[model samples]
Target: MENRELILSIKDLQISFKTDSGTVSAVRGVNFELHKGETVAIVGESGSGKSVTTKAVMGLLASNAKIEQGSIYYTWNDFHTGEKKEVDLVKLSEEELQKEIRGQKIAMVFQDPMTSLDPTMTIGKQIMEPMIYHYKKSKKEAYEKAVELLQLVGITDAERRMKNYPHQLSGGMRQRIVIAIALSCDPYVLICDEPTTALDVTIQAKILKLIQDIQKKKDLSVIYITHDLGVVAKVADHINVMYAGKIVETGTTEEIFYDPRHPYTWGLLSSMPDLTTNSDELYTIPGTPPNLVKEIKGDAFARRNQYALNIDYRIDPPMFDVKGSDTHKVASWLMHEKAPKVEMPETLKQRIEAMKRGEEV
Candidate 1:
């Protein structure tokens, strides 16, 4: 594999929200690194902190949300100076983030296009706004670039579509417009929060392919926040399996799909529907996620993990390096040397075998 430069790093990120009842810990010591031109997927159930972590990176957290701890280090080459620069995004003020980082260095494509788009604003103006605001480009220059971006994202009749309002386009076209806007600033990093969730299956596939092609063309580093492993299987170079408020497993795409270590990861993979599955009942993880209002002791996933050990209830497990792989790591007692061997469920094993045979699971 070619060595890639690190573009962003999140270290020990802890975030909480001041709810009416009490403080809810939304993210706990989350850490991940993204390299130039790499796509990293953060996958888990709703409320697992995937979106919160990325929101923190973008300085988009709500007023009640607090970053209790951690650092988000972002590196970029200065355009004028031609020198490397690095900053801790967590420490940047809202003003600094707005003026220097958000939408300029890093852009986000939200899940719902309707919510992201201004129904009253023309699509061309929406796409050109960032360029005009950030770069102080003339209207004519920004207009031409906006049209080009629309074409780049595969929107047909770019000039005409630019004149249409948000309500005038279909769901898929709206999403394409959203992608065009995210790329309008020529950001080095793209954060996609379930970008395809609202679209149909065929549209979902097309959008995923479009993002992949755009990433290659622009050499963009992407962070995808989603619950869909199916989408991760297609676009992710690496995977982080989040449970509760922290990542339970981290590995390269092949390692995660073929030899997932954490029980949470096994459950997630087993729940996915394979083409060969004939059972009427769909598989689901047995229990609901733990409440964030209460303090979590030991492993946050211990209560729901079918393969959990006694130690899982008493103490939190450190990230144990998986044997024979440098990139694979899991937070689970099962990885300890003295712990009894517990393999992933047999059904999941069969599914993995099918996947290895070029079948989708």
Candidate 2:
């Protein structure tokens, strides 16, 4: 296989928060890498730490959170030092990271435009903020570039929309403005935190396709944070299945959707409603995610897994290698040699087969 150029590398990463209740570990020993021009998605339910992990990458982790352990390294030519070095993102001072990296090198598009967008300012002013700060462009220059970006994201009334407020535009239009703002800086890596969560289904499809189109045109590496498996299947080149505060499984899109190994991953996939299913009721996985305040012992999913083995109660499963792709890995007792054959839910199996047949699933 041809080696893809590596852009971002995260290894043994852990992030914890010291709240009044207790220390809640949000990310635990998360390891993954992003290659140039590829979209990697962290898919899981709410409170799964998918958003937290990406926030760590963007240096946008909450004030209470601490980088407890591990390294998040990246290779980008320093405008100051004028040389490329493996910079540890976790080690960077807030001042240093904000001054050099954020928006200039690695930009992020937040989920809600209402929260991120400045209601008092025009869309044009908001989009130009990054350009003015990062590139030090004049107002005239920044507005011109902003207009171009608006058009690039398929906002037809670029000039009119640029003058509009967040409330005046539709949900889909606001999302495009957010994308335009993120792209204004010409970032090498774009972190999208549930970029289309608020939109309706049809608009979601268009927004997702717009992101794909933008990524292809710019050859930008992306970290997509989403809970929807359906969206992940369509947009992600690789999928990282997150649960509780750790990544339970990581694999190519096909490998994850078809040959899921972790119990948590199986549950996530199984819970997704099948539009093709003629059945009256939708499938659901049993139980809720564990509380992060307590010490997460063994496998976090063990309490909910029907097929969990004895070892899962005492020892946390280390990441195990899967065949074919050395990149494919799963943290589950099911991968151990002594474990019995536990098949995925038949619904998932049928869905995978349907996907292979190039049909809707």
Candidate 3:
């Protein structure tokens, strides 16, 4: 990945929302980078700030939301001049983002297709609007491209389906249409916010395959915001385990699954349903995430982490490089040299062994 071009870099991002009660710190010093032609999945429980961080990249934060610090640097090549360009997305105005970034250089496919698609508009027109608006293409050209896109997304009878409204299509078909719309202008980066969460398991598999295929065909970088670790095993090249608005662990897919270091990552991996397990009840992480409105003392996840040390309750831990791996990193007092060693649960060890043997766990 070092050789691949860096498409997006987020550094020290801090975001807050003003409520009637007080300000809620939504994102706290979050940092990550996306490379060209790779898929990075951000996984955690709801309200972990996964979607909020990506929304900032697209300039879609709510009016009450404020970015206290940080920069979202985007690097892309100019369409007309073929020159490399880089800009801080946070510094760009809303109008500037609309004209130059959104739907042109970067596009988003939301979780719910029904909400994303306009019920009043025809499918063809909805797909064509981005190209027509961004590239100033003639309606005829846009129409032709729209038909091609419909076919590319695996919708049958492309030209005929273009006339149908959102209600006429099935859930899976509507999601494909949303994907088609996101790719209408050939954007370099695609942010999928739980792209298949609204569909059934079978449909979710198909959508994941479709996105992976399109990524290979288009060489587009992708960011997946999801809580489903099963989905992460299938699609992610790298995984960022976010908890309480901060990334607690980051590593290659293999590292995070087979060599998890952080307690939160262990909890997440342990919660996955194992096929060979004898236990009837499913595992779950204990306790809820801490409220962000109040000032946090020490590690935010300490109250829920069974392996937490005394230092975890008194001081926050910095990101530490894992031993014998360059890609894996974790933030925990247990990673400190002086802290007592802790091991993951035995059941999780067995599950990992099953996975290593090429058996589904």
Residue ranges of candidate 3 with Cα displaced over 4 Å: none
Off by over 4 Å in 2: 1-3, 78-83
Q: Which window of 10 residues has the lowest lDDT sum in candidate 3?
A: 1-10
On lDDT, the candidate that comes out on top is 3
All-Cα superposition RMSD per candidate: 0.8, 1.7, 0.9
The better candidate by TM-score, 2 or 3, is: 3
Task: Tell me the lDDT of model 2 at 82.
Answer: 88
| Ten-residue stretch with the least lDDT total in model 1 | 273-282
TM-score of each: 0.99, 0.96, 0.99
lDDT of 2 by residue, 87-153 (tens): 8888898997897778878989898888989889999999998889878999999989998999999
Q: What lDDT score goes with residue 149 in model 1?
A: 93
Backbone N/Cα/C clashes per model? 0, 0, 0
Checking candidate 3 for backbone clashes, the offending pairs are: none
Give the lDDT ranking, best first: 3, 1, 2
Residue 192 alpha-carbon offset, candidate 1, angstroms: 0.3
State the C-alpha lDDT per candidate.
0.94, 0.87, 0.95
Q: How much is the lDDT of residue 161 in candidate 1?
A: 92
Q: Identify the runs in model 1 with alpha carbons over 4 angstroms from their true place.
A: none
